[model samples]
Target chain A: MVAPDYLQVLVLAAVAIALIIVTIEVVARIVRPHAPNPNKYETYECGERTIGSTGVKIGVQYYLYALVFIIFDVEAVMLFPWAVSFKEFDGVLGLGTIIFAEVFMFVGILLIGLVYAWKRGVLEWQEM
Target chain B: MVDLMNWAGIYDTIEGFLSGLGLSFIIPLTLYAIAALILFGFVAALVLVTTYLERKILSDIQVRLGPMETGGRRFHGILQPVADGIKLLQKEDIMPKNRDKLPYYLAPLVVFVPVFVIMGLIPLGFIPLDIASLNKNLLVAADLDIGILAILALAVIPTLGAVMAGWSSRNKFTTLAMLRSVAQGISYEIPFVLAALAVVLAAGSMNLSEIVKAQSGLWFIFLMPIGFIVFFMAALAEIHRIPFDVDEAENELVSGVIVEYSGMRFAFFYLAAYAELFIAAALITILFLGGWAGPVLPGVMWFFIKCFVIIYVIIWMRGTLPRVRIDQMLAVGWKVMLPLALLNLLITSSILML
Candidate 1:
């Protein structure tokens, strides 16, 4: 119940260090051909050879999808669990239900925003 | 737990160390082993069944008959996993030519281990088991103080494996898919973590049980609507399913990071994908649904029902919604979500402080 005691932290840190060493060792062993092909090292994040200049940048439509993702993602995680617990804590006190209802209202507002975005074509797929 | 750890001598060394570790540790370790084995066998079966059900349900939504080809007896497709196991067993495993054999071989294990560990953090169902005539808490393996952190920390590995798998394959499609996966993972993870942070703030403990307990009066979702929305979306993205699955976009990336994998190696990725889905789903249940908190049914049933329902939603959407563009996906993470998450955290903190 207390924050993992010092010993636990030390053990965890040790595990982390071991994992790092293991990673380095694995990488060293795996990179076989000693020839430094200047192109090979630049893969993905390491900026390897141009992988067709990545994907073309789309406009606000991309932003909108991510926004909606955030919106719906939060909705699913929070509300479903709340629904389960609300049924449990229910017993004459209308307070929890009222709070839950208020959340539904918030979701209602977001839906309105979504509809607005939909109408404004914010979520529409556009050619970049 | 210390006693449990003393019992945790490496399995390879078990035979030699058996008499040396003393019977005191042996007795408890034996009990722990039995309990763990039972738990594993049960969950493994559940994973298989849950997978079959997801496939069946998703197929039904798409108006396709699923697993009918396998059963040969009027949708008796429950035997599918058995058939799959046999086929995987019979097939020869192949390593990609340019792959790192060690981590490449380790990818599946890395993918699964995180999932197995996170199971402990979730308050699915606990059984009371006797060890050395002691009533030990048999529900979970080890319930850490930072329970949610334990889950999140372990959850990050599968994406790395996908990246490693892609890189090792030396395939263009996989590398592209993995790049998208990395972006998806990092983006979704930020919101998920922030959302968890919000819940932890409200609950005042990382222990999932304690968080569930905090909601005895009210669930955090009611107080923090934005938080719930952000969290669930992030969870969906984390699993790389349906709407957020541009990483594996079949038409675009052509099987993406897993294009080159086949046979049992592919099965490992498939199993890992489903496992990741449940692990994330279970976390959502624990964090927001009130871990094991429900009326009429026992906590585990309610927990599972809620989980299947969410999983069903993912399956449903897969057949319903068209995949979103990748950059748009990132935009959602940064432009909209990051801001909303910050606001939700701010509001929740202010409320708790007051």
Candidate 2:
């Protein structure tokens, strides 16, 4: 109950932050100068007028990094509960060794995935 | 209800004072407002101090006077941040032509709110004057069961804001910067989480206050030096501090994802960056340097002292180290930091088993 109540406080904190940002923006809007020119709205490319469409193709290497990130992110999440309860396992008879081995195996497989990604050049951000 | 009040010392006092006036019904709402105000003020003050210190320290490092004209030459420009903030508030809010509309307007808010929420989760040590004789961590807004996890989870969110800013701006530089930011952010987060996980394994608790309490004898930094280094490096990268700020490489990306933002919206990103810096420093203190644990000084003082020291190191790196290329940044994150963190976790867990 206390934890949930504290969570409510967390939500309240978030709401407060949003409100503060909005308040600042609204005040700024009222007080700040506004002299909008078409030239000022031009896309900034080191003060050079941007040539052609601003819609550019990003390298696919970014997607590869994201894909690899997800796999390891899930591994990290799975390890969280095990890491928190790791000491508790030590108190029981042989549970420590069993869980340790299981985690090792689980993480070992992920490490292999990481290595595979490295070998396949997924980790390398090749210049496109 | 009584138990809840007892845990929050100041909240209890305020509630009691209200109830004495037959106003118990409004206590919860009043406390919530007060808590929110306190947190906001704390974060705002932190940003101001850190920003000023950063300029002063960087100037010292580079052998120059920083901000002497703004506050006063005698006081060394202490009021410069306040002046800068007011100036920023009065700047024209620029809206780009042909923008995506929604994400552009929402990007700064998305970037700022998560970082602000993270400050609430950080345990800033107990109330030194324990008026109620209750040994509760009254400083942290939410002492969640998954405190560390929650912090880490919240840490990864600002990248979405960067991406939104980049893509929605209809600027090529921002789009490219957004791609690099996402890749870099996600890559460094692994090692950061793993390094924190190593500490969790040692402390056997995800709650940050519990982690600090577990370190009463010896700090985890000594027990697992690799974890500390990895965490610190990954954190530097995660927060986009220099030597790892490729996404914001001003020469290349023209301010990167925030290239298009102006005025108050721009200030949101600026505030968020400083706030993330504070949170990262606080996390380092809590995870490695032993949060709020020190001699002579009070726990709150010790906590802040440790945080500022880490912040000093971060700013020093910013002044000294050259930014790495995006390719090199990703390579270091994936190839080097991740394996080191996993090794730290394996060693810590194995040692615990023994």
Candidate 3:
């Protein structure tokens, strides 16, 4: 019963996806027009001749948003197992109140972080 | 009243038939191979049809006719996607000079494979089909115990491809798009997972088919309307549709991460996007709309109908709403959707306890 059926399905589907992608690409290579001039191969930037470097300084706002997201994302992941396992304590007296209070306390701490971010205006897109 | 597609029974029969033909050793391999092909074909065909439908629906919503020239005036250019696909296949495959070749090439496949794989796990509900004399129809390819988690895990992977595409393109526009995608992916995923966790909590199982079964009496939408709404909004973000399409703002980014890709490589990204659209709707259907649950139609038909209805809603959103800024997108994901999902979960837990 513990067989890796899901893994097998995944592998099989991966192979199929690969096969389809390859077949389409290879056929396109054979039959499609192949005309690659220097201009055609140039990175598309509104058809203007390339200028400036690709790696430029990005706004710190994006980074800040990502930081807040990562924090919340981790918290969400932890919450899932706890939520699922709530059934294990289904019959215990005061299970509902105990679990609710504990989970909310965990959420409340994260909410504090969120509130800090909000107050700092890091949640604003144009903050940078 | 319970009609099922009976894919499991059909697989057993096929295995038996293969054994009778004295090819028992290859049965497992053959069965999986066929299933894979079926799933691939299903996704490809559905994507093609939906692309056309989106065009036509959008045109109709805007009071115009769409694609009346393709497919010889019959079916309103239903074959336009096929024609467009052939045209794309025949177009020049351009590789931007001075770009990172390996990641550039691998990005589309990375984005596409997982999305394609997800289709096999979506249960279309049981239909009472008399095709192979099989009962107990399980419409999905595999009903893994961790179906919801498997989907959540795989859906998280496509952002890697977008980032790869952006970085490999060696362009500032793609880089900006990649940044937006990463932020969008991270921010939206939390709410998406939380909303889904609410459903999982209510259903008491992560298996999607079981979730559907739990909904037979009352769909989760009725019980957890806020979660359903959050799920829908986060889903739109996951697929990078309008209002959440900051990653690929056409007016600003040209084409975003796929800006440098051409030909079939470009088509892979296009295909994956449509596949994501379908899967998002299918997930909603299964989780909230009660997969294939309706009064009159067959389960499979009901499933697709519900999916298309959601698809229509999404298309309507694309047609109507202006794109939100990146920060605004994150704000909604973090500030609005996430907390609502948590509250919905807490409410659901309290209700279940009572």
Candidate 4:
């Protein structure tokens, strides 16, 4: 299937920008009050005033979870569209089986990180 | 209907076919640039309309008029997003005190741009790719072997914005919110990937159109509901919609990572935030709900409808649910959703093998 022409995309984009800009303008006028306060801006937590800035120290372990996640989350995203075409070029291109093995092993290699996180007790709920 | 998708690789064919008609050097580059701009603009329009639809539906679900008063006519809230755009334009683009200026301004565009880039890869209903007089059966865009990688590449940029926005705010609550976004982004992204990988394994291809085509007779949901559910839920969290919008919990971390932004920058953050909601919904429609597949309607119409329904559900969720605690959010990902997604994938693979 051939794609749409550039002019069409421009028309579509113009519609998008116009729609977005207009909508935001209206919503702002509708929702945002004419005046606000310092108290309103101060971090609202529960009914009471905030204690200790809500920015207390965090553990290094959380960082570990994130590190492992960054490596895999992005990788998983790369895997989806490939999965979409798995069987199409099955014989001629060998796109299907190759993608599976590559990603399976990718996940396999990354599972080690999960195990490490487990060993480090990132998955555990108990407090030390 | 004029199709922007024709811009995908159409220029190459155009130049090829039209070379007989005229001489051209700068034509291809100009055409590509124009196409990209259209693509961005189209996605921006989609995000805005989706945002309006989200609010409207959510308001209806809760028994309220969403933006009816905006146009000052009943049901004319249709133009609410348009109006909002004009407001953002006129509003001051305020920079926070003690904030890094470069990435600070760039963050919203960084967050917003990639959503459209991903949109490109999804075959938006097979438009005929009328090349240099050869009729070939294929999609409208570049069918790269690594199409999915482009999506991932784009997906990675938004989190950078989230973290950057938090850090640049230089406020304590903003910092905590930023850290929470890191945790949220990381946690949800895992199950999402795992479940998506499961789908890839089952479908055996990485191309989204191929995935949709494979499900022609039977959508993957019947064979892989658990994976579908997990993927949908994790995607929700990844996009930070309700039930998983802990990153922006008002009762806890203020507006989370984006507490400091105001005026258009704030609007940018807000739009970027809702952009995720719209993106996740579209993804679900494309991936699981069967991209543009239905009996009566045109493919694009079906795709758009399915996408809208998912968007409706996400907005409905926002109105109904209470924010989960950060710890509980993590636990659900690891304990509940992750395990279920993992088991679903394993069972799916085993069944396929059998």
DockQ of each candidate, alpha-carbon based: 0.05, 0.67, 0.59, 0.20
Q: lDDT: which is higher, 1 or 3? A: 3
lDDT of 2: 0.86
Among incorrect, acceptable, medium and high, the docking class of model 4 is: incorrect
lDDT of each: 0.65, 0.86, 0.83, 0.66
Model 4: lDDT equals 0.66
Please give the fraction of native interface contacts (Cα pairs under 8 Å between A and B) kept by each candidate.
Answer: 0.00, 0.68, 0.58, 0.25
Model 3: chain B TM-score relative to the native chain B: 0.93
Q: Which regions of candidate 2 fall more than 4 Å away from where they truly are?
A: A1-6, B1-26, B133-137
Which scores better on TM-score, 3 or 4? 3
TM-score of 4: 0.76
| Candidate 1: stretches off by over 4 Å | A1-128, B1-36, B69-75, B126-138
Weakest ten-residue segment in model 1 chain A by summed lDDT:
A4-13
Per-residue CA lDDT of model 3 for B202-306, tens digit only, reads 887888888888898999999999999999999999999997998899899987899988778888899999999999999999989898888877888889899
Report, for candidate 3, the interface RMSD.
Answer: 2.0
lDDT of 2 by residue, A1-128 (tens): 45545645566556756665665668887989978789888877778877787676767887888889899999999999999888888876559989998999999988898899899999877867
Choose the strongest candidate by lDDT.
2
lDDT digits (tens) for residues B60-109 of candidate 1: 88787788667666765778877876565444334444555676665555
Considering lDDT, where higher is better, how would the candidates rank from best to worst? Answer: 2, 3, 4, 1
For each model, chain A TM-score? 0.55, 0.82, 0.82, 0.54
